[model samples]
Target: MLNSWGEDIDINTTINTLNGVSKSSSSTSINTSTSTNSASTAKNGDTRSSKSSTKSLANSAKLVTKPVSSTSSFFGKFTGGGGGSSNSSNNSHNSSTGTNQASGSGSGSLTTTTTNSSEDTREGNDNLTIQKINASIGSIKGEDIKWDFWKLLRFSNPDKELLKFIRARKWDPNRSSIALTRTTKWKAYDHNVNQIIMDGEYYVFKNEMTGVMQNLTLRKAVILGHDLNDRPVIVVRPKLHSTAQQTHEELEKYVLLVVEELQLFFKEKTTTATLLFDLTGFSLSNMDYTAVKFIITVFEAHYPECLATMIIHNAPWLFTPIWKVVKAWLDPVVAAKVNFSYSLKDLNKFIPTEQLPKYLGGELDYDLDRYTPPDGTYDIHLNDKEKRTILLDQWRVLIAEFIKITKEWILSENQSENKKLWLQKYDLSQKLRAKYIEMDPYLRTRSSYDIDGLLVLE
Candidate 1:
């Protein structure tokens, strides 16, 4: 069931591999000298199946199709290039061996240009890379919706993060949570057939605490379908919980939930792909070292052969340090604010301070009173590299603290104690960050280091 290419193809693993296809076909289905008649029995979309006898082509070639039942699994569909007006034209397919070729086992080329397309739709569930996304498009499914085009098409636009997150979010557009799979449960004396639980893993909210207009979305899509060719694929989407009260405390649960869900997907794959997933919501704050280290563990277990790039939608300069901090390369940003952090800082050493950042001129102070609701916290303020600096340092410390706490939580099994709800609350993700602020002494604790201190020590 390999495509035209000889690459080691999968029957279900469509996680992160959709770069391009090899445009080469041999005398595929070159039938006999004469045309024969055959009966059509059944079909399963994009393919026809039945027991038929059309003689000559290869003297005899075998084709078989099982009866398609109401219940079947679909990995996903390819993205379709939108429709456009076309000049009226009539195209005909008349080969010198027309009837002769028609008698072959299969039909003609998989591609055909119509009013909708001027190019061959080389779209199937192939690998999706930067180059392929630029070349052409076809049956794009929810899981196949990617964000490599973030810079030019998306991030460059308004709400770039939101757009990038949506495109990068993965789902088996063909599959719905409304239907549950059949399962068998063990009984005391016998086994009973039961329906599987449909656990829809998702949640959403906006950050009212900031007083700025921002929403967080969380969703996870697990891909486990044999494609037309019977290759396996797995698609994953992390979570984001945005609320006016969203804080780092709530963010940790999303991270924990993501890690837990990913473990389930791994069990379904024989060997996994590059632990593929995306972040469409708050990239920097939502993404952390603990969350990242967990994914790196997945890559080590699953995708040992190749590299995996986890795209971050709308992650400004702040999120890049995640790469620096973890000492791993994975966070690929689509559209994010520029002129800050490690990436910009490295580039800035060559540039001037006045020419520093477009967003950091600090010329006008945004009215915090208007943007945010009645809260002691300022919704908007003048450009303070100091505040961002505080956030960055504390975040690093928080990541360290999270790792220690996470290990303790797991290892604490040997020992026993009564820790409060805050321990359950502060699992280290950002949405949960708010709950941290609402409770505990950590809220009043300011960063001990300053911007200059970070520069010197870092």
Candidate 2:
């Protein structure tokens, strides 16, 4: 039978392989090692032989090598294609474009398009849309409530964030605002996300269930490196999972912890991430539907436009049905970010060999066991209520100033004056971010990245 990606497979052979029943005499059967230890491990659900077969299939897989023109196609398809004109155009625009101006309605309808000799017209439209969003927030009766909404969202780069919502909602400001507000409330009240960050739930769980948390942490997922576009790469090994291991609540908290850690890696340009799922040695024992559904919900609803690509590597035939079911749950936009990879070469198309892990045919020799956890000593001084309160009060002042300038920037008709206010707003936003960093050690627990010196505060 042929799988969705057009890969040929013998269902009977796959079943026999999973059952630890050898069929080496059959021409279609995968070549097997005669080692007793390998057979014993497969019988115990380790599936070493199946992993070998997956690697063999990956080596022989033939994939399309043509270039794709559409931005969605470049990131979405599993074909061994190059990113074409669309990617180059975006790169050029990012590098060369300066001040953006909105050409559409003052309400930020995103209906008009324009061109300029010196700037990308889309930047102007996006900037105008963001201004409209700011204007909407400015209209709220209570200044404290308006600033509190911004604080609840909890990340620097308001323009970049607002743009994400706008693009996710197809450039409709009204829809984006609704989506943004929903996320804000969900994170603040429903999830109590700030408390989760403050409690450092992962560490709390680790202390309680040392053996399970240690094993899961070392094997399940890690933010290893970056992809070609400098987006953070999260490496997830599903084969390490088992439904019997962790409770639904514990699993949810662990996933949230990883995501919270991921936030520290985001820059102005690199807001999205590449998720690489290594499916080698995967079997029925590894399936966790509840965990999968929760993860899907977290990304699709709360973290919109945050996935650059999701690479499913070396998936066995057994995963096909599960993938079909999973695909149904994904939003069409989220589904477009999914890609299948059959080999190391396939992965290299998105992540360079230098940044890729050595086990995945890359130069980086990453060892999760060697990773150091942060000690609970970095922010002890901030435990003083008075000190922390003063810093937070200062932040509120900065937020007030930022919102004030942003409103002026939006209202100004003079090009030069608008440009000046834009710069002022930009500077205030940066200061707001810097202040957040100064208070981060107090607000949240230190992550592994902090211990490893990978967290860039500036």
Candidate 3:
């Protein structure tokens, strides 16, 4: 049932698409509204079932199997430097073509033998469940239960961390293994991250004429609240374009910063998040194909299962055409996780009236200036710019603290433990990055617009 775009989205697609709703509507029964047109159904929550079966096969893991020479394979060059230390376990190659080989002689392999789709899915779910249970009991590292700061930082919570990789790789151990390796490799660049977070002007968009990146009203995104699972729910308005001139690289860094902050804030509850794209007033002018592509690529490729769900709200007919183009970049599993809402009523089914924005048929009055007050008290007398600055300062402090912890931990550990941690970081980051780049072979050839689609306002 796979289509040129992905797969035949199934009934569960609708059910799972509203995972956020499952959290709030304890008493309400969810009834999906069907439309005559397929696109209408797609737009109204009748999304395609997760193309998980096809992806469960290792052959579909482009990130793991692809040659390491590609420029987009940034983590591939890192070589998981510390995983092969004297005290650590040995990595070994799996016979499977789709997965990356382990670093040492450890009996662990991602998934070497191919299983039927049913068996594969079952195994993947079982493993994820086991990881979740282990995480609850604090048994992440094979029976060793002491709370090591290195392991805690390496895995915010082992079960949730593994869940991100599992979701990204469709529960295939081999694919998840490769993904984990890439993430471990990414940790070595903490010093670079320290620099990036401090350079507020470089990270956040700045006006071309004034050179200030601190305007609160121009900010297009914010963390609204948490979902039922207590994962942070982030809201983005693609229509709200930044007046400041920003490059794709800078935009990516800023977004990554936001993801890091969210992870830190919700580390105790859930490592992932939910994204809501408000496309009600979106026009072709709002389209920034390159920036949008970069954002999606970052989440799907670099972040992995950190995404719980993405709901596109109130998209006009015009957005549908653009979505088809944009959807081409999404992995089947990721694509399946997206739900399109054509009306506030459609959104109301899954999201309670209280949790939604007032404009979208909810009671919450979200203020751009004081939506989130750092001190829990909002001084209404303060102007918008001042309030915004306070918010930014709060964010800076949070980011600084995160960087400080990560760097200090890495430095305090021995070489062997350090290698193991870096290996873990690299595996996740690489697998995510590789997956997206693999899908877009012409990623380099395309200009920014070609990457973003019509959503970006020129």
Highest lDDT among the candidates is held by which one? 2
Backbone clash count, each prediction separately: 53, 2, 50
Lowest summed lDDT across 10 adjacent residues in model 3 is found at 28-37
Ranking of all predicted structures according to TM-score, beginning with the best and ending with the worst = 2, 3, 1
Q: Ranking under lDDT, best-scoring first?
A: 2, 3, 1
List model 3 lDDT by residue over 214-264, tens digit each. 322355666666555656677788776653445555565556655644543
For model 2, the stretches where C-alpha displacement exceeds 4 angstroms are: 1-148, 152-155, 201-216, 370-375, 384-386
Q: Give per-residue CA lDDT, model 1, range 139-195, as digits (tens).
A: 222222211111111101111111122223222211110010000001100111000
- Model 1 CA deviation exceeding 4 Å by range: 1-217, 220-270, 274-283, 301-315, 329-458
Per-residue CA lDDT of candidate 2, range 435-458, in tens? 887767656666667766767765
The residue-level lDDT of candidate 1 at 165 comes to: 25
Q: TM-scores of all models? A: 0.20, 0.65, 0.47
| Residue 283 displacement in candidate 3 (angstroms) | 1.3
Better of 1 and 3 by TM-score: 3
Task: Give the Cα error of residue 164 in candidate 3, in Å.
Answer: 2.2
